[model samples]
Target: MSGMDPSAVPGPTVVDRRRLVFGVLPAAALLAAGCGRSNDDRSDGGRSARPPLALVYNGPQGCPACPETVAALLRGAPRPYRVEYVGGETPLTAAALADARLYVQPGGGADLKGTWRHLEGSAGAIRNWVREGGGFLGLCFGAYLAGRNPGFDLLPGDTNGYIDSPGATVTDGRDTVVPVNWQGRPRHMYFQDGPAFFLDPGADATVLATYPNKTAAVVVAPYGKGRVGVSGPHPEADASWYADKDLSNPDGVHFDLAYELIEATAGRR
Candidate 1:
């Protein structure tokens, strides 16, 4: 909140879906039968299968850089990790969520209105899945979706009062760099139109990072047996992103931040 500037950047509007592209295939095929049952039902004693990380990639409503984001996540993860890409006609079913350990919603649409409108069918399934023990990581638009909304409602009361605080896409969509105090260090993160979550009286989330304004840039909480986390900026941005914007990050700090996010939310599984 403090270091963030209200400067206008250039990019697609929150509802703009014209430039959408679907380029990546799922890293692993989703098993239809093992929906929400025991995750370790395939080993010697019918041990549960290793849980894979599920990522939402709705083309039209998804961020253009989502593929790169996923790639970075995969690179940062330990070997033998399994990741899956959902959406783009692939349904996010209850069985799929139950079989997995974590679910990720990348940044895209400005508001949950359009996101929920299209993926409304998976809403209940996701909520139930997380409540049952699945982990969740939401970035940018994904963060807003977790808040008080008709969508997934994974974080219902958490966003009660700050409905309007940077909820929509920044006035300008241009890529820019902003300073964020993550954990404790001042790190640079890619900024677009991202939210600064305002927790309500009964909100259950814990603020992890914030802009200079003290606006929440990252927050995490437990939902039933699972965990839910959200970020208002793109820590997943790679070197190409910085190059494109003429920004410099020789230390690859953003990737470290991204790796930490995965470890914090999905790594446990």
Candidate 2:
């Protein structure tokens, strides 16, 4: 948790339908069926008339960046990676999360709430998703979920509410700025503060990035043929998202890292 930037950062809030723009990567085209299933679900690269990927976001409704990101993945993925936003209705069945070859969780605090966390589903399914050749990624709160038992059990971190973090964002007032650590000073950071989650040593998580306070910024864990990755930061958000929330971040706001990671994940299948 050392060598992180010394400020706090945040995640995206709400996303309207119109804000999303869908486009296909013509070179790697496939049918909608394969676009939503993981590789394991398909017999022939998901081109054999089956789904390619199934995403279990299982969180509260009306997430702004959620739909847009899912739309982009379904439309832009080079390997027919179908993306679906599971409305947080019922808890995740052990079979549901296990059926896929890969799973992605964006950085919403509530995304890790309720039956989703503490692994309401079967612990075996959670372990199988990563231990038995399934792939997974967690962002912010999603990363927090990886640490808890019954959850994916990737990074052993704790989630905390905001206190003394330095970052900027708009809440109620125009031009209003909240504090959270971002890329760095004078670099501008946007944030929607969430709970503070720190990594636990026994978890054996492989971290990628973080706040200046040595927190679990980005972490990865390798289990069996399955893999677990997390971003204490939201590297997939855009500028409009931060402006709408009145926040500034320094890690280069426009990010394709999430997609790159997914690309590697999709390759496994």
Highest TM-score model number: 1
- Output the lDDT of residue 122, model 1: 79
Mark the regions of model 2 whose C-alpha exceeds 4 Å error after superposition. Answer: 1-51, 59-74, 77-80, 87-91, 111-119, 156-190, 194-204, 248-252, 263-269
Candidate 1: TM-score? Answer: 0.71
* Decoy 2 TM-score against native: 0.59
TM-score of each: 0.71, 0.59
Worst 10-residue lDDT window, candidate 2: 28-37
Error of 2 at 266 (Å): 5.4
**Backbone clashes, each candidate:** 21, 50
Residue range 33-79, candidate 1, lDDT tens digits: 00001122122233365535555454445344464355446533553
